[model samples]
Target: MNKTTVPSAPYTRRPPSPPQLPYPIFLNQPRRAGSRAEFVLTPSYDNVDPGQLTAEDLAIITQNQPQLVAPNVSGDWRYEQRREAQRILEFLYIGPHAVIRDHDFLRREGITMIVVARDSRLANRSMASVDRAGGTLGVRCQYIDVEGPRDLIHGFPQTIRDINDHLLSVYRGQMQEMDKNDRLLRKSDPPVRGKVLVTCESGNELAPAIVAAYIMSVFGKDMQSALQFVGLQRFCACFDENTKRLLQSWQDILRARASVARARTPVPGRPVPEAKPKRRLDQLRDHNDDEMGLGECTMDRERFLGRDAFVPFVDITNDNAS
Candidate 1:
C-alpha cells in the first residue's frame, strides 16, 4: 500500500505594474491671445505663400498671357525656312496656307516634297490649292492628318519615321538618276539636291514639333536639343507641356529601341566568360563600388599615350666620358 499525495503548486508572485499617467493628456494647447491676434493681422499676398500657387492659377496665368505672333513672311501662309545641317543640300521650309498658294516660290526653292501636317479638312483644302496650282511645278504633296495637336503628339514618332522613309526613297531615286546620267558620285556631297516643305494649320507649334522630331530621328539629336534647334529657326516654335512630354516619350522609345538593337547585334570578338560567385564580403564591397560608380583611372601607367608614354633619357655616360 503506497500513500501517494500530489504536491500543491508553488505560489508565483507577478512583478509590480508601472505607474500610469493622469487621465487627461492635452496634445495641442491653445495659442496665446496675443499670438493669435498677430497671426490674424499678418499681411500676406492673398494669404497664399509664394511657393503655394495652385495648378489652376498657373493655367489661368498661362491662358491670360498674350500669344506670341510669328512674323508674316508670306501673306497669310506664315512661312519660315530652316536648314539643319550645312553640308546637306535639302532644307526644311515650314509655313501655313502660303506654301500651297505660292507655286512659283516652291519651284524656285526646288522644294520637291510638301508634307502637310494638319487635319484632314485642312490637308484636303491645301491639296486642292496645290492641284489648282497645277502639277507643272513638279512638287509632290503628302498629307499626314491626325485629329488634333494631342493626336499629332502621340503619333509623332511613327509619322516622322514614315516621312523620313519617304525622303530617303526620294534621295535614293535621285541617286539612281545621277547614276543613269553617268555622273561621278561624290561621298562628301548630299545624294539629293531637293528641298522639303513641312506645313500645318499654323507653322507655330505642330509644324515645329514635327521638324524637331525629324532632326531627332535623322540626326540622332535629343528632344530638348532638337526643340532648341528648331526654336532657333522658328520664333514661334514653342511646345506645350503635353507636346514636350510626348516628344520626351518618343525620345525614350527611340533610345530603348537603339539599345535593344545594339544588344541584339553580335560583337566581333571572343565571348566573355561568366564570373565565378564571389564571397559575401567581396560581393558587398563590389556592390558599394558599383553604387559609387567612380570613373576609370586615366593616369594608369599601362595606358597608351604615344609621346607622353615615352620618357627621354639623357646621354649622361657620353658627357661623363668627355
Candidate 2:
C-alpha cells in the first residue's frame, strides 16, 4: 500500500531504571558459541520431515524462538488498533516517533533506549528536541542519519549491532550486579531488562525496515518471517518492492555468513584449530544487481522511457524495416 492511504516519544519522571518486561529479554542471546550449527541453523518452516529433534536441540530451539503472534499486552479493547509502540518481541518495540517523549508510556513499558530513524524529505517538524526529551526521560537516544526509508538499507547492519550490543551489555551489567548482591544477600537474580524502540516519523517504512533487519539477524529469520512478525504487531508498517528487494539482498548476505559460521563450528568430538582472526562483516555488503531480480525489465526498454513512449524495433532485414 502507498502512503497516500495510511496515516501516522520523550520526557519522563521516575527512576532511570528500565522496567522488566513480561517475556524473557535474553531469548536470542546464545549460551555458548563455536561450531554450534544446530543453535544457528535457520529453522525450516517448510513441509519437510526431520527424523527427530534431540532433547538438547529441542531445548535450545524452544528457548531462542519467540512466539510470533501478537501479544496480549494490555486490557484495553483497542490496544492493537490504536497508534502505539508495538511490542514486537519481549524487549523490542517498534512504533511512531511520538513515543520518545511519552514519559508515562516509556516508564510503564520499561523502555531504556530509543533509536530514531528519519528522513529529511518526510520530516514535517524538527527532531532537535529528541535528545532533550530523551535526557529528561533518562532514556538513551541513538540516531540513524538516513536519507529516508529507501536509504535505510545502509544503516541496517549498524542499527542491528547497536541494539544487540546495548542489550547484551545491559544483561552483563545486571549479571555482575546480581553476583555481587547474591554474595551478601543470597537472593535470586532478577531478570535482565532492556528495551529499545525503533521508530521513524510514521513508523511505516524506515522504522519497520530496521525492525525487520533486527529480527532477521538476531533471530536467524528469513525475510518473510521477519516482516510478517512486524506486520502482525503493527499493521501500518509498509515495505515497497524496492525496500523488499533490499531486504532480500540483506537476507542473502546473512545466509552466506551463517553458512561460513556453520562450516567453522567444530563437530562434537573434533576440535577445529583456531584460524587467524579476520575482519568482521559488521556492514551489509551490497549484492549484485541481478541478485535483486531487476534484470527482468532489461528488455522492456520502453518502460524505462515511459509506458506511452513505447517504441518497437524495426525489422531492418524485412520489408517492414524502418
lDDT of 1 by residue, 1-322 (tens): 1233222344345985444322221223354654321111111122122222333432222232222221222222233242211111135666665567777677677777777777756544546776654476777777777776667756665666555555555554544325666884544354545467777766766777787666555444567666555554454455776677767776776666665554554568957455467666433344544556632433242456564443233445555688
- What 10-residue stretch in candidate 2 is worst by lDDT? 45-54
Residue 185 miss distance in model 2 (angstroms):
9.1
Tell me how far the alpha carbon of residue 309 in candidate 2 is from the true structure, in angstroms, after superposition. Answer: 27
For model 2, what is the alpha-carbon lDDT of residue 177?
34
Over 4 Å off, model 2: 1-66, 71-82, 120-129, 177-188, 268-322
Model 1 regions more than 4 Å off: 1-90, 120-126, 175-192, 270-322
Clashing pairs in 2: 9-97, 9-98, 9-99, 9-100, 9-101, 10-100, 10-101, 10-102, 35-265, 35-266
User: Candidate 2 at residue 171, lDDT?
Assistant: 57
Best by TM-score: 2
Which 10-residue window in model 1 sums to the lowest lDDT?
Answer: 36-45
TM-score per prediction, in order, is: 0.51, 0.59
lDDT of each: 0.53, 0.63
Model 2 deviation from the true structure expressed as Cα RMSD, one decimal place: 17.2
lDDT of 2 by residue, 1-322 (tens): 3433322124355778644222111123233443221112243422111212233432233345534444222222254444678887778888888777677888888888889887655456557557766777778888787775567777777787677667765655544333544652322255446788888878778888888877676666778767666665576677777677778778887777666666665679887777777755432233443577655444455556744543333333444453
